[model samples]
Every structure is written in C-alpha cells, then in structure tokens.
Target: MTRQKATLIGFSAILLWALLALMTIGSAPVPPFLLNALCFGIGGVIGLVWIGFGAGFGVLRQISWKVYAFGTIGLFGYHALYFTAFRIAPFAETGLIAYLWPLFIVLFSGLLPGERLRALHVIGALVAFVGAGLIVMGRGDAAGAVPVLGLSLAFLCALSWAGYSVLSRRLGDVPTESVVVYCLLTAALSVPAHLLWEVTVWPQGGWGWLSVVGLGLGPVGLAFFTWDIGMKKGDIQLLGVASYAAPLLSTLALIAAGLAEAKPILLLAALMITGGAALAARASLKP
Candidate 1:
C-alpha cells in the first residue's frame, strides 16, 4: 500500500500495543530494570522475526551505522529513563509528561530538512497537548512535583523522546528494521550490566518476566515495527496526525484494565483529541 496508509496502520498498531502495556498482563512483581530488559530483549527477538520473514538480512546490512547507533541508543535511553520515572513517580504523572513527545515533534520538525511543519501542525500540536492534559487531569492525577526523583527522570524521558523524534528523520534511507535492530542491540548491551549490579532485578519472578516479554514483543517491538513500516509507506504529515491515535486508544485500554475510571469529562477529552487529531491529519493532506 501507500506510505501514508502504512503510517496510519503503524500508528494504530502502536495504540494497540500501548493498550496492552497499560493493561498489565499477570502482575508487576519485579523491578523496572529487569522487566524493561526482559521486554526489550524479547521485543528485539520479535523484531528479528520481522527481519527474517519480510525485511531480510541484506536490508539490515544496507542500513546506515549512524541510524543504527542513534536509533538504538535513543530508544535505549527512552526506556531507561521512562521506567526509571515509573519507579520514582506515580504512573499518571510520568505518563502524562512523557506524552509530551508529540509536542516535541513540532518543535523539532522545523529543524528537519523538508519538514517545515505548517501552521496546521502548530494548531494540531496544541490540540493534542490539550487532550493529553485532559487524560492526565481526568484520571485525578495532577501534574505535581511531589515525586522529585521519579518526576525528574520522567522529565528526562520526555526530553530524550523528543530528541529521538527529531533525530530519527535523519535516518531517511535507513531500513526501519535497522532502527529495530538498534533497539534490540541496545537491549542486548544492557543484559550484561543488569547481570552485574542488581539483585532482585526486573525479572524477579515468572509473571514479572512475562510482563517484560509482553512489553518487548508487543508494544516496544511489534508496535514500533508496524508503525514505522506503515509510516514509510505513507505521507509524513498524515502519519504525524495519525500518531495521536495511540494515546486515545491507550486510555481506552486503561479503562478496560480498571486503571482508568470512566468519567464523562475524560471521555469528552478523548473525543476532542480524536477530533483535533483527525482535523490536523486532514489539514496536512489538503492543499
């Protein structure tokens, strides 16, 4: 299909997996680091399956080292910081701040070569930000600075994520698989470090390890693979607009998992974000 279609599909998959992640499969009875490593490692393996079946090894070799290095490291940094925030702060607070990556895209898009982000982008960003605010506030979790450590790390996660969004475009010709490889490789690098310092590391128990596996294979791995591949097939502008669908879907997933209480206010916010993102997507498509 077309690149825009692929992007839309990819982003939709991201939402699906994000929902899975927020759902909590068995129970989180492990440390964040161990669980993160397990997830990344498993996710990496699943990504390899994509390479093996569809993309191929030659594609992997053809990808730029720069893309591989930056993408891998960038992803690694994002997860590390993000999970750290979870350890230190409340989930709602960390998640809300972390969602700021969409806005980060707007700020960084200008510096990107050929992506002069039109006025519509600015408006869309504001709309999405508003939606994020509703999700954060609607859940009864205000943006407080009480969890100093977790909040600070959460802030770092947002910054890192923003940098990744801006920088990934530089890998224009690199295979999306290569970026996936970078992530897997980064995960591989962490295993050794984890084996050393930590005690009851993330994967402390079977269920905890399963949680890691789910995160890696579904959200982090499979979700990204499809999303990037889809984006590669679609218009970047349209893809950008569709990306907002992830958070909205994620909220729905949260409600199903009992993490989110169904309230008229939050539902309204989700609708607004959805509408705003749809409009923004259309704006990018029109002359």
Candidate 2:
C-alpha cells in the first residue's frame, strides 16, 4: 500500500483502541489473563477464518518461527507487564506511565534506517503526551506511596510496545498475516498464565460476551494487523504522534457509554492532541 494509505490504516488501530476501556468494563469480573485469553483466542479464530477464505493456511507456514516468536512476545509481554503493573500500583499512576509508549515510539522511530526525526516531531509528541497525561491523571484516584517495582514495570510496558512497533519496521517484508500466529501464541501463553495466576470467570451475559467479541474484532484483533502495516510501510513518526489520541478518544468513549463523566479537561486535551497531531502531520509533509 501507499505510505499515506498505510498510515491511515494504522490510524484506524488507534480509533479502535479508543473503545478498549469501555469494552473491558463491559466484560467485567473476568480477570485480566482470562480476558486476554478469550480476546486473543477470538482474534486468532477471526484470522484463521480470514486466511482460510482468501490466502489459505499455506501463508502461515512461510513465515519464520523467529517472526512468530517476536510477535507473540510483543503481544503477550505487553499485556502481562501492564496487568502486573496495575495490580501493584495505583491505577492512575500506572496508566499514566504506561501511556508513554507513544512518546517512546516517536523518539525511537528516528533510529529507523530511512526515517528522519525533525524537531517538530519531538515537540508534538511531548505536547500530545501532556494531553494524555491530563486525561490519565484526571481520573480522580487518590495517590498513595509510590510502588517502585510497579512503576518500573509500567515503564517497561511502555518500552516493550514502543520497541515492538519500531522494530516491526525492520521486518517490513513480513506479512501482516503473521499476526495471526502471534495472536494464537499469545492466547496459548495467556491460558497457562491465567491458570497459574487467575481464577477462571467467563463473561457474565450476552452484553459481556458481546463486549469480549468487540474487543477481539477491533482493538485486540484487527488493530495489530493494521499497526503492522503502518509500521512497515506507513509514516511511523506521524502515527506515533497520532497515537496519543487513543487515550483521549478512549475517555470520550467511556463518557458516551456512561462509564465516565465528561470533564472540561477533556476539551482541553482534545485541542492539545489535535494541535500536536497537526504539527506532526506538517512535519511529515515537509519536503
């Protein structure tokens, strides 16, 4: 695909991720690892059905086991660390730290072989980060003593995702189809982890099950595929800067669902994130 088209596809992942919190709430009482297992399993099944209808399972065999390993580690490790961090730290603090991935992605994209990192990209990333931080911190949770280990894990969670995204550029030749393997392997891994750490609790009802399906179809499933395409062929820096919009959009989704209250700060965050994305887009447009 053309760079512009790929970037737009990647941006779709961010849009889909905006429903993550709301969907997770709807799927509630299901523990994190079990939820991961369910969503990734559903995502994997979707991929399998997709492949069966079009390219067939032959395409999967062509991908290297190394690629599968990398993708699985990226998907599973990120969720594992994120869940662990929140379990140990205050939700607001852990979440704010975890949201640093976008900033990290923007910074790290400069190191990619053909990419140029302009000043505006950094400034834009920082501006967007501030907006995301406002949303995370505005959750009104009381702050307690800092949990160093949890904070460290949260930082690593950011790093893990940023590294995965940027490194995927180097593997540009890999088919997005390989993400199917990644999802399946991640689900497999989550199954054992859930058995070890969490009690199994299925979705409570039709709404709960629908929420799980929604997550698999959108945020957890298709998002990775589109993001891979974007990282491999799209404007990575622009996508990185634009990723900050996920949190803002997610909060809005929550408010619309009546899971969260609409706040004045969200309006300010909207402006800041918009301006930051505009700056990044301008930078990318420079000849």
Candidate maximizing lDDT: 2
Kindly report which residue stretches of model 1 are placed more than 4 angstroms away from their true locations once superposed: 20-27, 53-56, 117-145, 195-197, 202-209, 262-286
Find the 10 residues in a row with the least total lDDT in model 1.
18-27
- C-alpha RMSD of candidate 1: 3.8
Model 2 spans with C-alpha error above 4 angstroms: 83-97, 116-141, 145-155, 263-287
**Candidate 2 collision pairs:** none
lDDT of 2 at 64: 93
TM-score per prediction, in order, is: 0.76, 0.83
lDDT of 2 by residue, 73-180 (tens): 999998778766755664444554666676677667767776677888778777866765665556555333457788788779878999999999989999889999
